[model samples]
Target: MITRTFSHLVLALIVFIWIVPFVALVSTSLRSETEAKTSGFWTAFTPTVLGHRFSTHDKGSTVEFIEMSGNIFDRLNGEKSGFLVSGEVQSILIKARIMNPDKPGKTKLIRKLVPAGEPFETRGGSLVFQSNGDFTWTFPEATAPKPKKLDVFINQDPIFGADAYIEVLFDNKNVPNALISSFIVTIPATIIPITIAAFAAYAFAWMQFPGRDWLFVLVVSLMVVPTQLAFLPILQGFSGIASWATALNAWLTDCEINDSCQVASKSFPSLWITHTAFGLPLAIYLLRNYIVGLPKELLQSARIDGASHLQIFTRIIIPLSVPALASFSIFQFLWVWNDLIVALYIGPNNASDLVFPIRLQKQLGTFKDQLHLLNASAVISMIVPVIVFLSMQRYFIRGLLAGSVKGG
Candidate 1:
C-alpha cells in the first residue's frame, strides 16, 4: 500500500509539472493583449481589473458607454461620472478612454478594467449591487417625476477573466491563410519522406547487397550535419535550374525569358525537397530498426510459398509495420510543421510560398508591437500535432518500444 501510494504521488507530481506549461500557453493565447501586457501570461486565470477606465472622449458628464453584452453601463448626465449599477460586477465590457502614450492626445479607447467579483456602486444614482452581478439603479422622486428604476445581470466565468479568444481571433486577420500554408508545407513534406524512407529501410533490413552496411552508415552520418550548411548550395542549385528552365522555355515556346517563369526563388517545391532531405536520415534509421526485428518466420514461410519480394513487402511487411510508420510519420509531421530555419532559408519572405513557421517568424521580427500574437500563433501551430499525437499516441509508444528491443 505504501509503495503504490508513493508511486501514485510521484506520477501525479510529474503529470502536474508536465501539464503546467501547456495550461499557461493556452491561457496566454486566450488573454487580451492589454491584460497580458500589464500582468503576464499566467494571470489570464485572474485577469487584472482596469477599474472603469472610460473617461470623457466626446465631453460632458454623460460618457457614452460603448454597447457590450446587450448591457450598456453608461454614466448618467450628472455632477460626477459615477457607475450606473451596484453589486459585484461579475464581469463587463465597455469602452473607456485613457491618456494616449503614443503622441499628444487627451484619451484613447480601452476596455473597462472591471473584473468579476469587484464591488461597485453609483453613489449619486442611489444604486446598490450584489456579488451575483444583480444591480438596482434608482433615483430620488425629485430627480424624475416617476422614479427611474433599472436592473442588470452580468454573466460570470470563474475560470477565465474575459472572452479574449474572440477578441484575439478578430484582431489577427492573417491566421486563416497562415494555417492553410502551414498544412500545404507540412503534409507533402511528411508523406514524401516517410514513403521513401520505408522503401529504403526495408531494403537495408531484409535485402543483401554489396556495400549495404557502408551505405546505411553513410546515410546515418548525414543526420549529424546541420541544415544551415546545405541551404546555400541548394538555393544556388535551384536558382541555376530555374534559370536554365526559363531559357529553355523562351527558346522552345513564345514566352520571354525575363517574363514570370515562376520556376524558382523560395517556392513550394523547394520547401518540400528541403524537408525531405533533412528528415530522410532519421526516418530510415527508425524504420530499419523496427523492420529488422519483425518475425523472420513470416518471411521464410512466404518465400517457401513462392511469394515475390515486392508481394511480401507490400502485403506482409507494410501491413504489420503500421506502428513504426505511424511513429515516424508523427515525428516528421511535427518537425516539418514546427520548423522555422529551413523555411527561412528556402522560403522567401513573401506570403505566396511562406509556411506557417516562417510567417510567424516574420510577425515576431517585423511587428514587435504585436508581441502578444506570438502566444496565439504558437498555439495554432500545435493544434494538428496535438490531435495527431492524441489519436496515435499508443502506436507511437509501441513502435519505439518494439524497435528498442534486441536486434535481429
Candidate 2:
C-alpha cells in the first residue's frame, strides 16, 4: 500500500511537470501583447503594473500660451480588446533638465514623480493628473520647451480574449493555407505506409516463402539507417522520374506549347512516397511483432476450413490487429504532422504548398515582436496530434503490451 501511494505521488508529479508549460503556453496565447510582454503567465489573473513612455505635444516655436488636455491612456499603442480593463494611474514621472550641482556650466537630465491628483509645476508648464489616466497641462506664455517625456505606470485588471487566435488563423494568409497543406500531406503519408506495412508484416509472420526470415532481418536492419544518407539517391531518382514525365507530357500534348509543364518532383505524391518509404521499416517491425503474437489456433482452423492465405489474412489477421494498427497510425500521424525537415527537403516550395511548421517558423522572423500570435499558432498546431493520440490511447497500451511477447 505504501509503495503504491508513493508511485501514485510520483505519477502525479510527472503529470504536473508536463502540464505547467502547456498551461503557460495557453495563458500567454490568450493574453494581449501588452500583458504577454509585461508579466509572466503566473501573474496573469491578478492586476498588473505596466509602464508606458509618451510625450506631450510640441508647440513648435509659437509664442502663444496653449493648453494640452488628453487622456494619457490614449498614448498607448492601439489595442482595442479592453486590454486596459479598469486602468488607473499608479505613478507618473516627467523628464527634466537641470543645472549640475557638481559641474560648473553643465546640465544633466533627470525624471521626477508627479504626485497623484496634484498640480506639479514645470519650467514651461503646470500639469494636473488623475488616477484614471486623464491629464491637463497649461503652458506659460512664450515658453516653447521641447516635448517633455512622461513615463506613466498603470494598474490594470486582467483581460483575456481570442484576438491572438483570430490573427493567427485569419489575418495571416499563409497560416490558413499551411493548415490545409499540412492535412493534405499528413493523411496520405500516414495511411499509405500503414497499409503497405500491414501486408509485409503479415507475410513475415504467417506466410511460407523462400528467404523469408532473411528478408525480414534485412528490413529490420534498415531501421538503424539514417534518413539523411538516402537523401541524395532518393532526390536523384525523383528528379529523373520527374524529368521523364515532363518530357513525355510535353511531347504528347500542348504542355510544351503553352509552357505549362510542372516538375513532378516537388508535388504531393513525391512527399507521400518519401514519407512512406522512410516510415516502412519501423512500421513493419512493430506490426510484425504484434502479429506474431496472435493465436496460432485461429489461423490453423481457418486453413483447415480451406481458406487461402489472403482470405485468412483479410478475415482473421486484419480484424485482430486493430490495436496494433491504430497504435502505429497515431505514431505515423504525429510524426508526419510535425515534420518540418522532411517536408522542407522534398515537399513543394510554393507558398501555398508550404506546411505548418515552415509557415510557423517564418512567423518567427516575420512577426518577431508578435509572440502572442506565435504562441497561438503553436497551440493550434498541437490540436491535431492531441486528438489523434486521445482517440487511439486505448489501443496504444494494448498494442505495446501485446507486441512485447510472441505466441508459440
Candidate with the greatest TM-score versus the true structure: 2
Clashes of 1: 7
Assess every candidate by TM-score: 0.72, 0.85
Clashes of each: 7, 0
For every candidate, C-alpha RMSD to the true structure in Å = 8.8, 3.8
* Worst 10-residue lDDT window, candidate 2: 76-85
Model 2 Cα lDDT, one tens digit per residue, 82-131: 55445788778877778999998999998887766888776567888899
User: Whose lDDT is greatest here?
Assistant: 2
The residue pairs in collision within model 2 are none
